[model samples]
Target: MEVEDQIRRIMEGEGLEFTELDVHPDQAKPATLRKTVSYIVCAVILNDQEEVLMVQEAKQECFGQWYLPAGRMEEGEAIEAAMQREVKEEAGFDCQPITLLLIQEQGPQWIRFIFLAKVTGGSLKIPGEGDQESLQATWWDRVSPLQLRGRDILDLIDSGLKYHQETWHPRTLPVAIPCSHVVQRLVLIFSNAEEELWVLLVKAPRLHLPTAGAVKTHTLMWASSLVVQDALGSLYYDQEVTALGVLGLQHHYHPTPGRLQSRCSDGVCFNMLAQLVPDPVQRDRDGEKLEVVPPSQPPPPENPRYTWKRIQSQATAEELFPTVAPTSHQDGQRADIGAATVAPQLPPRPRRLRELGSPEAGPGAPAAGHTDPTAGSSVALRPRTRP
Candidate 1:
């Protein structure tokens, strides 16, 4: 009679399709189950100005749909290799994927991996080149809600951008939430070289799905605090921390999750963690702060390496750590030296996700670790170094 019972019976009757099934006890009874063998591939392509390249769908299931260049992983093919091939085939460009962007769900039935890809060679191809769908492909100025086909697509793009940006700048481990359907968390570290890490936290919009959202009615502040506490316990680092600030929260309500994805009529919102940077002033050339360090300046020590994995969204009350609160609060306090600021409440934005991958002299074209079928001898790719 209960959802869990119904799910269990359905699974037993249908014989599981995914590798596993997870059922959690919450007020609403949240469960996540899937066949273990399934995998997905996605590409986040950027142009000359660092803008992204996306594809419009021509498939009947999602006709007139817009999504990052992507497709499903084939049997026996590696995820990374498949990604490289998919992008080249779909976008008509040869790219070397640098990092794991975001592992997210497309809808109730699909899960995907968004990768940051650097254009190594070739130009963007016109749509009618050996593809079945009569779709069009184009590049966008930024990876934001406007670029996405649906509300859910917005989160995927945002998280992918952030992952690409902070891969090498000392980021926190991906937060694992046991939410029923979605696992939402931040993935970067802001280092001021202090005794403690002062990171940002954003609230999870009610409309978005997290395993935690379905079962409990919790506040943003509480969720923010829990993330820090969980980070302190999960990560391997040294330093004490203090909560410096809580920025205002904004909610974008249009384009509900249930609405099927499409190219038009999708809305999105952001809850941001505002950091207080002290070095707001730059030495002036003559007397004014010269416009230097374009926001596009790739993070220092480029081509950082990262290891990523998907975590369950639902966590136990003990795992949430509501009781383990911050020691004290200060308006603007100095953090500990080499302190790692853990931003775990929201997903990292995608264009930002571009820069984080195995250090250059590295790495995707798929089937795990396949060489690019179309990679030319003149275009050199970095070799992978073993640890």
Candidate 2:
């Protein structure tokens, strides 16, 4: 009796629910149940011939592909009307549909409507004089698998031809299209104090595209940093010694030098003149004269410091030996003497963190005439002192 009672209760619940069910779709399914409308794309082919009109594809989404004239259907446009308009715009010729070639359904979001079209009239031409259309339309023959630009085109064509004799349904899914961007780097250098900056533009030739021009393949940050190192090593004594911060920049598509600009860390731009002197004992005995002095031979222990007082020695000598020397000389002789004048002595200014212009010689501090305090500085002979 208990088992029978349980069965009775289940049946009563089922009966009540079934009695309340509505069979009409208006009550059973809401209007919102509609699936997303799939788009219809068309492929129009001219009659059996060696030439089939085609156009080049653009944009990172579908780059370098040749596909049939196709697009999404506009509001109120019949599916056939959309196909006709697409063919006219893409192929520039009137096309009459003969048969539906194939259908490609992709996911719940995409549908492709393809057809066999016959060329009737109006010469096939590219749309918008080949500028606004983004492609040049032309006739082609012997469509090879290798010649097709994208897998979509190849798949559509093969499916159409293969299924021409029978009806078939295809199960497909959406695929992600990948894209990339190019990066550019710039190095700005001020070679003079007049604020005249020279930009060094270096790029790998392979990174450029025939159409796009100087496409950057890396991030601007990485490019700029690498270029900074390269510029310092190739142009200066040390990267740490001379470097500036980046300046304003705009996107550049042209292939030119100095696309990027920057300012030196220091406001001034200057040149560095360095000399290395060897120990007196290790001075080169057999080699040609060199700017660098070896370590084995140290410079003299004491020498007059380089200063205006030392530089004025010649003027003083001329004054003291007035009776032995002529005050006036030929212009050519003076010019020759001037050319051989001693290098201007400079003082040490703390090395600026930037290079913006030719540096002025620093003032020399008082010291042994022939000895520079800095370990790497040069030593020059000073006037001899009478004992």
Q: Which of the numbered candidates is closest to the native, going by highest TM-score?
A: 1
Q: Which tens-of-lDDT digit does each residue in 101-124 have in candidate 1?
A: 443322222334556777787767
Clash count of each predicted structure: 55, 23
TM-score of 2: 0.31
Report RMSD (Å) for each prediction in the order shown. Answer: 19.6, 36.0
lDDT of 1: 0.34
Candidate 2 lDDT by residue in tens digits, 1-387: 222221222212211011111111121211010132334556647445534566655434545556667776554444456677777776677877654443333211333455666677776665455533325566666354424453344433443443333323121111111101111212222222221222232222211101110111211122233433333443222221112211111111122354322210101001111111122232245854545422232122121210011112332222111011112221111111111222123222211111111111111111212211111111011111111
Candidate 2 residue-wise lDDT at 183: 16
Candidate 1 lDDT trough over 10 residues, lowest sum: 377-386
